[model samples]
Target: MSGLPDILLAAVTGFGCALFFSSIPVGPINLTIINEGSQRGFKWAWFIGFGASIMEAIYCALSFTGFSSFFGNPGVKAVMEVLTFVFLLFLGAKFLFVQSVNLPATPLRAAAEKIEARLEQKLHPRSAFLIGFVRVMGNLGVFLFWIVLTGNFMSHDWVADALWPKAACVGGVALGTNAWFFALCFAVSRGHGRFSEATLLRLQRLSGVCLLVVGLFDGTHIVWQLARHRMALTS
Candidate 1:
């Protein structure tokens, strides 16, 4: 409506964009969540998403609220890049070497029965939340990602400059991200029985390999660029 406040419009639209971005099937974290949901129930899945959403909100706020410039510093950038690289490598190794999550995909009713029969292996609430938080944080440099995302929105005139609207947009990012994650969890929870343990293990290893390759390439590129920049400055 024409009567809609500019900030509200930006926030709403920005939220849609963030939701789409979060749903993009790129990251290991999403795969992990799906696997978790497919094995555990929806409660476990949602808790993981909740933790991830919190971090996503924090970063979105930082990027949109002028803290992005602070992270753009060379030292900070380097540190984030290095940490991401190391974490990705370690995660990949863990995926390759550790016992994969191989829970049998029983029907929801059956899963509940089994849980009553014994302890459930699905991530519990506290574990899921903390794990999700740690997993999201491992994908460092998301601050720059949000900055670029918001900058593009501004460039395209899809966003407003006012403070409240910007905050709203950032909140939307978290909401959108959480929404997508919840949707993913819902889908997985419904079909958890369809996934065989072999299938789950294969997917896990595949995602791990993908993460490793992405980290190696991206991490090295960042290091190379930093080195070149330093050499140029010194020369």
Candidate 2:
């Protein structure tokens, strides 16, 4: 493929990966930041997204370097699957048990408001950059997903040889994934606001249920897979 076409294709693939994955329950950190930014301001959101993109880039680079293979061993995969399952289950249980809405007057809400107020006070470029950095660091699942996607892309023969192309592909995907944050910020900042706090809360609740279902399904699948592997070994 020509460079332009190749870059475009890479960008599409990157965008697709981000869009699909972001729809998943665990993938909503970017969305959360975006929404928060909409409520707070774009500058804050921009830094958060930028920081997340940087971490994603680092993970993609590492994945490209074959670092994820360390976790590809059957034993390691099994362990990871188990841990992931447990974590998801825990998250689901917590969602089911906890109160779904936060009152603005609640201490937790107050604390959050204070934090945002502080962030607003420090809303310089440097502070925005720091916020972005910190937000990305806090989002571990997104990092892991980026690593996996990078590993998969690196394994492909068509585009593997060209470092620039590969980097572009990764960058394209990161941008696509983080695009939601920017959009949300822009929308909220525009003041043509479509989503209310109630709407956001409802969506969050629905997302939590979806996460719960996915966790149960994945956990069951892992158990079945482990059983089959054991049976094959014995047979």
Candidate 3:
């Protein structure tokens, strides 16, 4: 393949890969979006996703530029896994322990909520964008994910070793990531109103527990791998 056809094919592959992977089971990024959407509404949540999409594109481009080896290095990969474990564990605990504001209605509660609304209003899109950026940066999984994906595409000769095709694919990744985030934010915002305050609180706690479970699983896997590696070395 050459010219526009090659570019188009690579772009489509990148788009499909980004969308499919991003839409997979609950992870830090999506969980944060869901939590924030419930609390602040669609705009805040969407901004976060937008920031993440930008980072996704950057990471995709990095993959084409051969940064994948850095991420794949055993030492670097181990540190990233450890950091990801800690990050997930921290978020899980934060969400689990943190109290939801919209409790059962009381006269004073209205005033309290008004103050909170004012505060949330002060949270500009820039702040939300930064939060999204920082959140993804902390996760490390996003970089590793792109590493594996880009490698697969290259190995299969799906994307050529050329500038334009790679750039087009990176652009497609941004679009695909944003598309999923938009749909998720829209759905969550639309359904948010239907939920009672108490229900929302429950949902928050449930998401927290799920995050904790995922973190624990990741930590366990890391430990298992380390143990096996040590045994092999000693043997």
Candidate 4:
């Protein structure tokens, strides 16, 4: 392929991969955006996506620059897993018990109520951004995912290792990620009026349950690995 075509292919590959992955609704980031959009509105929820996309781009760049080995280290991976487990546990419990989304009869009053609740650092635009960023940071799975994806892309020669192609791919990833979040937030916020507070609260609780399940799964895996290692040593 020629130079421009190579760049385009890399960009398209990145975009498609990002879009496909981001569309998966299992992650904490997705749930947070949904909760925020349904509770607050689009503007505040969208900033979460902004911060997430930026971190995603950084991860992509690191992957492209061959920093995958850093995250691949056993010690680093163990630390990340522990951190992720703890964070998931805490966030899951919080979401499970969070009372009232501040939904009032009037949108204005609802907004006012939300702002007042946010004074306790519950939810706001800036905090939403930080929440997104922090959530992704604790999510070691995302970093490992990028590592594997970029490695596979390079191995197949689907994306050239040249700086330009890699940069284009990273940019495409950021855009693709942000696009999904925007669509999700838009849909939830637009239809926010259709759902009762009870239903919204149920969804939030469901998200918490799912997160806790994932964290438990991870913990189980870690324990199993340790047990196997111990057996090997004993043998």
Candidate 5:
């Protein structure tokens, strides 16, 4: 069908969005998911990634359908942004505080030992699914990103005429976006044995800091947007 290309393009867009968002500061959740899945199998990694993609699809749908507008209210957005920033700052501090000397013994080289000990026990399938679900839900960065993308699409002049096609494109983007995170986790986890534990810990810390920075930036942006909206309304 001629519509297929549109759908594929949409999927690629979604993938790119997800990749860009996830590539930023890594976090325990993503890293853990990757490491766990790597320990288990690539299929599990794929499943987790797929599950995350589905969540993104739901959010995208909500944004496109105008349901996201309820939360998009200037006041609400401002509050959420502040909360996200504070959360990130707190996480960053925690990462900075965690001493690396407390890890258990492992055959992995010192570089890898740190990470192996930091890794939580293997995650069950149900747990992984739930984690994937929660991660998507709590990930304000990704949520806002999709919301913006969907909003832009909806505002277009052709939105009404090409509703179905546009929707398909958004869905595709969601799938593509999520695939990257899942793939990363699977790949790293599979090869974790080859890396030093210390290297793993360092990676985790780096990811934590990255998330914190993103959270701060998002929070500030939301606040500024709210202020501008207030000024305009009063004027």
Candidate 6:
């Protein structure tokens, strides 16, 4: 650890830790990336990672700049939390209901191909990118994520208020996210054939159920907190 290398080394280390901690969680974004990676291919996974990482970088910057305070208001925060809960439940329901039953043999394969071809046409690179971006952006929880991360950094006095450190950290997050998605996509791609359609369908249903439970638990917790806070304010 000497000269510019010291700073660079520290930045890289910080980046890796942040990325690992942020990505290791079993969130909606991870679920989406893994699902798409297995069903689609490398390209699909890359785009999802690209879009999500870009947005994540933006969130990091916003957090560093203290722009996420908009959600600090109680009413606004509660509303956003409820919305997130609803989205989680909705996404789960969709996954649970959309069962891809096995089709008949050769004759039906032709018709399925035709339909798949149409789906392929629609799921262009741009579409994949948009889906990733929208999926991450629509969730208000991410705003809180960066806000808390930045706040923790500030409290720890880890990095100064300099621009370069912030940029480095953000870049590190993007790189880390990309790395995780790469691994996930590669692993899922390997299982493409081994997992039958029914298995995938069950996995989807299981994901939905997990998400639904998460929403219910979180929604209740948030409501309880809100009630307590309201009581405190009144008292």
Q: Which pairs clash in model 6?
A: none
Clashing residue pairs, backbone N/CA/C < 3 A, model 3: none
**Candidate 3 lDDT (Cα, 0 to 1):** 0.72
Candidate 3 Cα misplacement greater than 4 A, ranges: 67-126, 193-235
lDDT of 4: 0.73
Give the Å error, residue 125, model 2: 4.0
Please identify model 6 stretches exceeding 4 Å from their true place.
1-10, 67-126, 193-235
Candidate 1 RMSD to the correct structure: 10.8
What is the C-alpha lDDT profile of model 6 across 1-235, one tens digit per residue? 1345434543674577455544442455666766787778878876887777777778777887764344445465556666666766776676667655332245444554455455445664356776666556555566666665554343333444566665666777777777776676676677662545566577666766776786788678777987998999999
Error of 2 at 151 (Å): 11
What is the TM-score of each predicted model, taking all chains together?
0.56, 0.55, 0.58, 0.58, 0.49, 0.54
Consecutive 10-residue window with the lowest summed lDDT within model 1: 116-125
Q: Can you write out model 4's per-residue Cα lDDT over 2-63, one digit (the tens) per residue? A: 49988999899899878766765545577778778888999888888778888888888888
Residue 139 miss distance in model 5 (angstroms)? 4.0
Q: Measured by TM-score, how close is model 6 to the native structure?
A: 0.54
Per-residue alpha-carbon lDDT of candidate 3 for residues 158-216, written as tens digits (9 for 90 to 100): 67778888888898899999999998899779888354546556656665686688779
lDDT of 5 by residue, 96-198 (tens): 4555623334343443434334332333335566556555655555555566555433332212224565576666656665667666765666675254557
Instruction: Assess each prediction's global lDDT (C-alpha) against the native.
Output: 0.66, 0.58, 0.72, 0.73, 0.56, 0.62
Residue-level lDDT tens digits of model 1 in 1-235: 2224867777786688677656644454577777788788888988888788887888777676784454445565556556666766776676655465633333643544454334323533348887776555545445556765665455334556556667777778878888988887887899883656566667667756865886688577776887999999999
* Model 3 worst lDDT run, 10 consecutive residues: 101-110
Give the TM-score (vs. native) of candidate 2.
0.55
Clashing pairs counted in every model? 0, 2, 0, 0, 21, 0
The alpha-carbon lDDT assigned to residue 31 of candidate 1 equals 71
Q: Which residues of candidate 4, in runs, are more than 4 Å off? A: 67-126, 193-235
TM-score of 1: 0.56
